[model samples]
Target: MKIRISKATIVDERHPDNGKKRDILIENGKITKIAASIKTEVDKVIESEGLCVSIGWMDMRANFRDPGDEQKEDLESGLKAAANGGFTAVALMPSTNPPIDNKGAVEYLLNRAKSGKVQVVPIGTISKKRAGESLAEMYDMYRAGAKAFSDDKESISESGLLHRALLYTKNFDATVIHFPYDATLIPNGQINEGVQSTLLGLKGIPAIAEEMMVARDLTLLEYTNGRLHLGPVSSAMSIKRIASAKKDGLRITCETTAAHIAYSENELENFDTNFKVLPPLRSEQNRKELIKLLKSGKIDVISSDHSPEDEEHKKLEFDYANFGMASIESFFPVLYTAVGSSMDLAKLVATFSINPRRILDLEIPEIKEGVRANLTLFSISEKTVFEKMNLKTKGYNVAEIGKELNGKVLAIFS
Candidate 1:
């Protein structure tokens, strides 16, 4: 159905100054006209008063476990969750059982996502099968529509191997997302390494485990003159490292998960498996530093990280429980709750909408005339509760579950 949105506040995010109330026209899946007081003739019209119109949100890192573990989470369910979150594009991580290492898997994901409303960009695996030993067929996968390459679940800390992958991806002018973690430094660590771990009687994942790899990765990136992306970087020190690297003009970008920004090791006192995650949550001080860094333009993007685990895996003891949360549905409201009023609506849209597209080198869809009708409508004043059972994904392990949240995604068009 063709529709026109009138009297809506527009916030493009990429350009904060352009945010103001305006009338927008949409027809045949493309934005036809946008002005302050445009006369629109359409079969349907939406009088968006308090709601804000902006470019569609993009989740730079999402693990939709299809083509292998659909029961955990599939492409269809993931897209539904994304649409519900006001996202129009998602970068699918390659952490499936076989991993997205070859051309066949890339094509399958592209075709599958083509049938959906949201755009899905396949992320190829940097290491074959995510083994961290041999490099995957980067050239072949890139040709098959892989926007970027990453080993989502684990990090390739091996210096020599990572160097090879970086140089290999350079041929295609694509970025290789690195999961920064030093295996030896972080052995069997459950939560963040701190007083919380000691009081809770749990193994600790040291901050150095993440910071060390990030230091090395930045150095290698400089030497190879290749693009490097730090995915879901959790540690405070890691953010500092990335900031320093960027200051030096290193071609590096970083993203932090919503969990990392909202909660901290303090959430682990209840022994909640949903609080556990890769590069586990850090102290409150670390959480504040991350938020500050995001405001300072150090962190380039924010993501869902969206790892899905079965009940058997998350319902067990804290140590044996899986480390992740299903965050797609709760991503926006939770983040808004965390950074409400501190950053204006324009900056908020920038983090979720335009920044992600820039990081992945995607063409940012504009709110002007003649662009695709790709947009998200939302109201920052609204609030809702996070009910796990009501979520679309099979994975119900989320720290924000059952919590009341602000900012609701009203609709998404793509």
Candidate 2:
């Protein structure tokens, strides 16, 4: 398979051709040559104005709902959505019906995703069956190819359990990913706690719910000297805490979602179920703070948090609806539309391509000759519409439909 990418500006900072427009040639899945111009015959040629190339993007957190709730999203559909979203790899959350807490489950996901262009890295459960009562087989699952350990969207309320898990994973140099929220504080809450919830007569989830857990986790990480990744964080205070922890030299990393940075609680004014998400969209002030911190590199990665729910679970009253959005296909477009003008292209590429892989201890691909062609091609000037037809996931819960976004993913090579 031969392909030529003409007049594309390289966005990888590690490459000498960074920010320079050049022709790239790939033969048999490896980069063969790069020059100012190449007049060569190939199986396909890709050329476009404002075309940009980077190391393949990776999503650190996402829910595919495979092996149990395939009706919502299967491995094939999820990988297709990831490829369309400019991600060559995604970390699957262990939140399925039969949770991925064992060696067999981790092996199953790896085997199923082996033939796909988009890689699937399974995240094993932190607790047995995601029950939060006992620790899962961390070492065994890690040996079976699980990249990290997490109980997705399920907060660990017991301090002793989290402490034990952190200490246990340290022996193998594994990272423990935790969603920062205290469920007990907002068991019935529907949206961010503020004027919107008051005006709509719905229960509200206060920012303290997230901040308190983040503080607890940071303390645990500091005491145990273990690597910890916290994310899909929404509160401004939580970000301040994580930033301070980093200054104190704790082994901590965090992430925020595209939806969190792009939309606020204002989207819930109309009772749209698609706008309902966990760590619900915060106030406009918090959204701006998130963007500022992300630009300053306080945040390490940006994930889609692509949770897919079937219509039966989504098309209900706001109070009863599920908390998620099928957002993988719209990930890069939403971020590009919301923050492209104010962000540096190289820094944005690092968040998606370099930082996430480093956090997970995975191999980071380079955009140089003699390397395998794991890359994403995109155009910042191209405009795309987010509509139902563009979605590849089985769930149709995206809230950005009908809006025009600034970027388009041209193709993926893996």
TM-score of 1: 0.96
Candidate 1: Cα lDDT at 381: 73
lDDT string, candidate 2, 1-414, tens digits: 889999999998888889999999999999999999988899989998789999999999999998899999999999999998999999999999799999999999999999999999999999998989999999999999998999999888999989999999999999999998898987888999998999999999999999999999998899999999999799878888999998999989899899998999999899998999998999999999989998898888989999998999999988999999999889888888889979888888798889989999999999889989999999998988987886788886977789898899989999
Candidate 1 wrongly placed segments (more than 4 Å): 15-17, 38-49
lDDT of 1 by residue, 267-331 (tens): 88888888888878999999999888887778788888888887877899888998889888889
lDDT of each: 0.84, 0.91
Mark the 10 consecutive residues where model 1 has the least summed lDDT: 12-21
Predicted structure with the largest TM-score when compared to the true one: 2
